[model samples]
Target chain A: MCDSCGCDLASNNHSHDTDSRIIEVHQSLLAANDAMAARNKAHFEAMGAVAINMISSPGSGKTTLLEKTIERLKKKIRIGVIEGDIETDRDAQRIRAKGVPVIQLTTGGACHLDAAQVHKGIHLLEKEPGGARLDLLFIENVGNLVCPATFDLGEHQRVVLVSVPEGPDKPAKYPKAFISSQIFLITKTDLLPYFDFPVTEARREALHLNPRLQVMALSATSGEGFEAWISYLEGLTGKTRKDNFPPLLSQS
Target chain B: MHEMSLVQALLTQLTSLAAEHDKKKVITVTLTIGPLSGVVIDSFQFGFDILSAESNLTKGARLIITSPTVSYHCVRCGSIQTAAMRPDHCPECSETLLIAEGGDAIILNQVEME
Candidate 1:
C-alpha cells in the first residue's frame, strides 16, 4: 500500500476478493449545495428577479442596509427579502414595515443559510403580496463572518459589509467572506469621524483578498454614499429583466 | 456547527455508495480537505466518528483525511509556491500580493467497501 494515498491496487476494483470493491468517487462535499444554488439561481431568473446574499458579522448593518435599500429602490423596482436568523423574525418585521414582500427563515441554531433553506424561503416568499412580481431579492444571511462564507444561497451577487466600529482588520481576519463576496461594503460611514476605522486600509485589504471585489463605503443610517448601492441594484434589475427573464415559475 | 451537517451528508453518500455497489460495509474512506475549505479536521473527524458508529454501512469505516498544499500565486511575478501554511511573501519577488489557488476543496476521493 502506498503510504501517501493509501492505494494497493492501481486500477479500481481489481481484487480477487471481489466482495470488496474500491469505488472511485471524486466529488465535492459542497456539491449538493452548489447544485441546489444553481437551481435556485435559475428559479430567480424565472421570476425575473435578481438575488443578492448579504453576509457579515452581527451588527454590521445587514438589515439596516436592506431597510435603507428598500426605501430607495422599492419605488422604481419591486423588492422582496428572505431574512435568516437564529432566533427571531425582527429583521423581517422591519422590512415588512417598508411595504415589501418579506419572509423569515429562523435557522434555529444553524450558523448560515444553505441552499435548501433558501429554496423553501423562496417558495414562501412568493406567497406574500408583492413577492410574485419582485425585481430584486435580498437574502439577508445570519450575522456571522466565519461560517456563512462556505455556503452559497443561490445569489447572483454576494455583498459583505463591515461597519466603521468593526475596524479595518476584518478583511484580513476573515478572508473567506471577502474572497467569496462580489461586493465589499464599508457600512456605518457616518461614524467614521468618531472611530479609528481607516477606510482606505479596509478597502485595500479587501481588494487584496479579492481583486475583483467591488469595494464601496456607505452609511445606511445617515444615507451617505447610498446612491451607489441603489444604482448597483438598478443595474442588476435592468440586466436581469432584459436578457434572462424566463417563464415565471409562479408559486402555486 | 456546520460540521455536523457535513458529516450527515457524508454518511448519506457513503450509505448510497454501499447500496449502489452491492456492498454491505464500508471499510475505509479517503477525503482530501483543502486549507481554505473552512472545515476543522478535528471537528470533522469527531463528527465522523460519532455519526459513522450509528450507521451500518460506515460503522467501522476508517477515515483518512489528507490536506493538499496551499499554493500562493504572486500577483507581481505570477510565481506559484505550495506550502503547508500561507507563505508570508512571494519567494521570487518578495511581494505581498499573492493569489491563492486550489486550496478550498473538500472532496471524497476514494472508498473501500465490502
Candidate 2:
C-alpha cells in the first residue's frame, strides 16, 4: 500500500505527490498489444500452424508471391492467409480465390498491423470454411517497411521483401525491417536484367546490417529462385520432399 | 499513418489509467523509443499533439520522449559504441561487421496524473 496516498500501488511506496507530483509508471504503452500478441501466438500454436509475417512496400509482389505459392503448395500443405491493408479487401479477394482460408484486416489508415488487430483477424478467419485448421499461416502485413517493424503480430517467422524496382538500397534505408526480420526476400527479380539492381550489393548490405538474415531473390512470374523459397517453407513445416529436384544453393 | 493508431492506443491507455486513478487531468507522459524501434519520433509527437487536443483531460498535457541508444559491439575487436543512429563501421577496428544490442523498445515509462 502507498503510505501517503493510501493507493494500492503494488510493490513500491514511492509517491507522485512527494516530488513535483511525478509518478514513476515503469509500464509500457504496448502492454495491451503484447498481451494480445501472446494470445495470438497461443491460438496459432493451438491450430498447429507456423505463422509468417510478410513485410514490404506496396506492389512488392507479396500478394502475387502468395498466389503462386498457394498454386504450388496448396495440395500438399494446408495454408491460411491474413491480408492486412489500409483499406479494401482486394488482397483478401486474391488470396480467397486461391482456395485457401483467408481473412482481411483493414486498418482504415494505419500503416502497420498490430497484435490486437491480428488477434481480432485470427478470430474472424476461424469463421471461414477452412480457417480452423492450418499447416502454415501467412500474415501479409500492411505494405510498409518502417512502422510495421515496431509491432509484433505473434509470427514465428518474419520475411521482408523488396522488389527490383524498389532497388538494393532498401536494407540500408529501412534498417529496422531488415534488422527485425528473419528472412530478406528480393522480389520481382525477373526485372533485374533491365534494372540497375546489383543482387550481390543488396545481399552484402543486408548481411552487413544483420548477419543472420536468410536472403533470397525470386520472381513470381518466371519462377526464378522459387525452389529455394519453397524448400524454406517446407523446412519450416518439417516436410521433406521425396522428389530428386536440383537443389538451389544459398546466395553468398 | 501508423502513428495515428499508436496515438489512439496511447490515448486509450491514458484514459483507462486516469479512470483507475480517478484523476481529472494529465500533466505529463514519458515514452522511451529505442533507436531501432521503427517509430519516427517526430511523427509520434505530431500525432500526440493533434490527438491529445481532442480531449480536455489530455489537452495541454506535455509529452516527453526519450530515445535510448543501442550498443554496437565490433565482432573483430569487441569494442563497444553507443549511438542513436547506426554507425557506418567500428571506430576501433574499422570493421563493418558490428552487431547491435538492445534499444529496440517503444515503452511508455511514466505518466503524471492528478
Candidate 3:
C-alpha cells in the first residue's frame, strides 16, 4: 500500500515511483493582485497623494458627484481622476473638462477593474500635465457592485454609493460591497421626495454590515448636505477652504 | 462572469504547479471558497468545467471545493458566533450590530498530480 496517499499498490517502493503524489500547498488566489495593490499603495504615498476608489451601480451619480466635488475643491486642492468603464472615454472626458488631469481605463468587457489596470492608469496619469502632483486621486471603478468589491485597487479609502432612485435595499442585497467599504454615500438626495428610498433604513442596513462605515447623504445638483462631503475630503487631504476668508483678511 | 476569470487564474496556477513537480497531469485540486468571498459556487464550477477541459494538464481533473463559515462579533455583548450564513442577531445578546470577520478568502489548498 502507498503510505502517502493510501493507494493500493503492490510495490512498497512506490515512493521513488514519482508517478503520483499529493502536494500540500495553501495560498490565496488573490495573492498576486494583493501584492500589486500593496505596491500601488506605496506608489500613491510616494507621490504624496491619497487615492479613493468609488464603487456603485450604473447611474448612481458617481461621476456627477465627482464633477461637483472637483468644481468645489479643485481650486483649494490638486485633484486627479482615473475613470474605469466598459467602453468609451466619456467619463474621462467629463473629468478632463473640469481642468484636471484624468485617465480613462476601458476594461473592454471586464466587470471590474483589477489592481493591474489601476497601476497602468497611474502611470499614464503621471504623464499628464498636472498629474505628477496631486493631493487627491480618485479611481472611479467600473459601475459594478459585485465583482469590484473583490478587487483591491490600493485606494486609501473605499466608498460605496447608492442613489435615491436605486432604493434602500442595495446595502442589504450587496452585502460584500458594504462590508468592504469605509464610507457609504447616499447620493441624489434631491430625488428623495419622489422616490420610495428611505435614507435611515439604508444607513442602518449599511451600518449593520460595517459598523465603521461613515454614512452621508448628499445631492450634487441641489448642493444639499454637500458640506459634510466637502469636509470629509478636506479632512483626508488636510486642506481647508481658502475662499472662506477674503484675500485682504487672510493670513499670509 | 468574473468566475471565468478566476478559473483562468486557477488554470494558470495549476499549470505552473504541474511543471514545478515534473508532473504531466493533475488528478485533483482542492480549494476553499469562503461564503463571503462574493463568488458564486455554481458559476465557479461551471467555469472550471469549461476551462479545465481546454488544458491538457488539468483536463478531467476533479475539483473539490469547501466553504468555510464566517465569524460575526457582537458589538453590544462582545460575544462571537460562527455560521455559514450571516446571523441576523447575536446569539447571546440579541444585538443587531454584528461585524463579520474572515470567510472572505479563496484559497487553493492542495493538489494531486501524476
Candidates in order, TM-scores: namely 0.88, 0.90, 0.93
| Candidate 3 segments exceeding 4 Å error | A1-17, A243-252
How far residue A144's Cα lies from its native spot in candidate 3, in Å, is 0.9
Model 1, A1-252: lDDT tens per residue?
A: 544445785655345665887889999888889999999999999988999999999999998788777766666688999999999899999999989999999999999999999999999999999797778999999999888898988899999999999999999898888888999999999999899998999998887767779988998776678767876888888832243322122110
How do the candidates rank by TM-score, highest first?
A: 3, 2, 1
- Residue-wise C-alpha lDDT for candidate 2, range A8-104, written one tens digit per residue: 9864657456433555766666777888888899999998899999999999999999988888777778999999999999999999988999999
Worst 10-residue lDDT window, candidate 2 chain B: B1-10
C-alpha local distance difference test of each model: 0.86, 0.88, 0.90
lDDT of residue B106 for candidate 1? 87
Kindly list the per-residue Cα lDDT of model 1 for residues B4-83, writing each as its tens digit: 77888788888888888889999999999887877888999999999999978889899999999988789889999988
lDDT-best of 1 and 2? 2
Q: On a 0 to 100 scale, what is the lDDT of residue B102 in model 1?
A: 86
Candidate 2 residues lying further than 4 Å off, grouped into runs, are: A1-20, A244-252
lDDT of 3 at B106: 91
- What's the true lDDT of residue A195 in model 3? 95
Candidate 1: lDDT of B16? 86
Query: What TM-score does model 2 achieve against the real structure?
Result: 0.90
Task: Using DockQ, rank the candidates from best to worst.
Answer: 3, 1, 2
